[model samples]
Target: MKALKKIATSLIILALAAVPAFAGQQGESSGILTWLFLGFIGLIVVGQLIPALVMGFGMVKGVLGHSDDHSHKHNA
Candidate 1:
C-alpha cells in the first residue's frame, strides 16, 4: 500500500511538472495577459531559486569551515 501511494504521488508530481511544457503553445493573444503570465512564471522561478541559493551557500560555507563567531575566549 505504501509503495502504491508513493507511485501515485510521483505520477502526480510528474504530471504537474509537464504542464509548463504545454503552456502558451496554442495561445493566440500576446498582450498584457502574456506579460502578466510571464512575470508570474518568473516570480515562481526566482522564488524557488532564492532558498536554493541560500542553502547552497550554507553548504559551501560548511565545507569550507567558515563561521561568523570566534572560538577564542578573552578573560579580563
Candidate 2:
C-alpha cells in the first residue's frame, strides 16, 4: 500500500509539473476581470513613474545647478 501511494503521488506531481507542456492558446477572448487587472497594473506603473520622473528632473537640476529664479535677483 505504501508503494502504491508513492506511485500515485509521483504520478500526480509529474502530471502537474508538465501541464504547460500541453497547454495551448485559449480559443476565447479574455474576460473583463483580466482587462481590469491589466488596467490596475498599468495605473500602478504610471503612478510610480510620474513621481520618479519628477524626482529625476529635480536631481538633474541640482547636479547642474541651473535655476531661473536667480534672474530676478540678478536684475536687482
Give the clashing residue pairs of candidate 1, or none.
none
Alpha carbon deviation, residue 19, candidate 1 (Å): 28
- Specify the highest-lDDT model's number: 1
Residue 15 shift from truth in candidate 2, angstroms? 38
Residue 27, model 2: lDDT of 75
Model 1 superposed RMSD (Cα)? 9.1
Model 1 misplacement above 4 A = 1-29, 66-76
Root-mean-square deviation per candidate: 9.1, 17.7
True-structure lDDT of candidate 1: 0.89
Q: Estimate each model's TM-score.
A: 0.48, 0.51
* TM-score of candidate 2 versus the correct structure, residues matched by position: 0.51
lDDT of 1 by residue, 1-76 (tens): 5986899899999999999998859856689988999999999999999999799978987989956778789998
Per-candidate local distance difference test: 0.89, 0.87
The digit string of per-residue lDDT tens for model 2 on 1-76 reads: 5986899899999999999975776677889999999999999999999999799978988989965675554544
Name every residue pair that clashes in candidate 2: none
